[model samples]
Target: MSELETLNWQDWDSVLVVVAHPDDAEYGLSAAVKEWTDAGIEVSYLLLTHGEAGIQGLDSAETGPLRAAEQQTACDIVGVNNLTILDHPDSMLVYNLELRKEVAREIRIRKPNAVVLSNFEVEAYGGLNQADHRVAGLAGIDGTRDAANPWAQRELLDEGLQPWITSLIIITGHDEPTHTMDLNPESVAAGVASLEAHKRYLEALPHHPKPVEFIPEVLRTENGFAKTFRVFGV
Candidate 1:
């Protein structure tokens, strides 16, 4: 394990967050995102799915649009510049060349200097991780590299989407994070608000802890609020 250090974003101009579901960003990386956007770095969210399978009792037809709307609302709270939702099946993401290409397309289009992603480990927070998250995270990693290699996705060149090399990839929800970011009260509040935006989804959970409660509890550090992440440098 590497020694934990304060997250470094001194040179980052823009960031792209990739996730499998609607509230994944909120649970995993929202506070850090709040801090980033507050510092004037443009942030964009790329969701592989509309999170149709997130609500237990809700049908996909209803859950899809509902979650999408909530995700956009959440994005607005953090000053995210843009949001793009793809048609990948919820709870069924596959880590294949196709998935990598799709993610690469977004990376190329957005040309973000840094990318934030969900944890891809087989286990996280001391429990088994979901398959979709594992797939999405792996895809985010590969796609970042793919976006930098023109020959990896030749079609992107035809679409006028130039190759982009993301300098950093930040993975949230790891048990042992390599980096940490201090969060001010305002930033933490913004993150809470963003999580609360998913009213329907959160309400549908069996025993969903209120964002205000769990967020602060999880983020509380010795001095103040903070969020940790595992980082990969590209």
Candidate 2:
């Protein structure tokens, strides 16, 4: 693995962010995303689920829409206007044929040169990272390749969705990463604002005496300084 020198940032035209739930990109890669967008790159976000399973006291049926709405506001804050949700059920996002096809279709349509997502291999806070996170990450990577291969999924071609292959894949949350992009001050602010937008979701967590503490830990932790990701193929 090699960490390429800081990118030109001005050359990228389009980027696609794929994650398991809402706010995943914002917390994981919004900083780098800001720089890309500022450089005139079009950033599209594809979340596999609406994160309805989040929340400690509210019903998922109710919380899902709320979280999704929050995600919209968060993306807007960070200058990302293109967002899509697969609306898959939370906690049970299966890595099956249907999921892969849908993800592939989106990739084909977006045709982004770069992709960003959370790490699938890292264990969660208690050795239990969200199952959907891992499922989505694996599927997103596979979907990128599947999207570009005509023989991979005939049904997609029949549906008029062409295949697409992204040039780069960046995975956040990995302790040892190949690339670290130093975020600018504007992006750091955007990251904080983005996480704050997830009001309902943050309140749902069991940790912290109050919901206010979530922001500091998230934006100021060891993983907070520079956005790190594994760069495949170099």
Candidate 3:
């Protein structure tokens, strides 16, 4: 296999991570978030759903707010202070025009150099990619384009949102990654803590794997801990 390319962190001053649900970023990207924040890069999170249906036997009403709170704590651990959780139904996400416009609005508001998202592919190395994940990723990709076009979402412009285009889109959980970012020891620790912050969510899982055990493996690189992404230049 060809070697993965190195992501040039210096080129990005800020990033807006758009994902389907809570704890999504913590799975693998939080380490990169910690690393970037340590370097003084601004990072924000935009969750399309609160992951209300992630746990079985849990009412979505209660689970929604609970997961949101957990996500906020997770973000805090990873040094992300800005977070927005939209009220989209879990497991029923659709990459429709409305969703695309919503994501575009956030992009215009945040004005980041790049956007990060989970993989949109049908299957991942672990198993079938969740429906919400796939939909959100596809919407995120289109949203970037919509944000750049003033005519695409004219109502947003009327509402005082200006068109903005990010330089790149970075997708995690890809079967094939194009770029990798090495994480420092501090970042690795912070990443572990970030996932651990999802206490209730992890507990609800049928199998509870400690964050430290899985995080290091997910973030592993030839040199050390790292995070990988499939980058698309916009």
Model 1 lDDT tens row, 135-187: 99999999999999979989889999999999899988888789987889888
Instruction: Write down the TM-score for model 2.
Output: 0.87
lDDT (Cα, tens digit) per residue for candidate 2, span 1-234: 554454334667788888988878765477677777777789999999988877767888898889889999988878887999987888899998788788888888888887776878758544867788899888888887788788997898888887777788777776557766766666777777787788877666646333234433444534445566766630
lDDT of 1 at 81: 72
Residue 163 in candidate 3 has what lDDT? 95
* Tens-digit per-residue lDDT, 82-150, candidate 3: 899988889898778999999999999889999999988988758888889889988999999999998
Q: How accurate is candidate 1 locally (lDDT)?
A: 0.88
Better of 1 and 2 by lDDT: 1
Off by over 4 Å in 1: none
Note the residue pairs that clash in candidate 3.
none
The regions of model 2 sitting more than 4 angstroms off are 1-9, 122-126, 206-225
Every candidate's lDDT: 0.88, 0.76, 0.89
* Per-prediction TM-score to the true structure, in the order listed: 0.96, 0.87, 0.96
Candidate maximizing lDDT = 3
User: In model 2, how many backbone clashes occur?
Assistant: 2
For model 3, where is the 10-residue window of minimal lDDT? 217-226
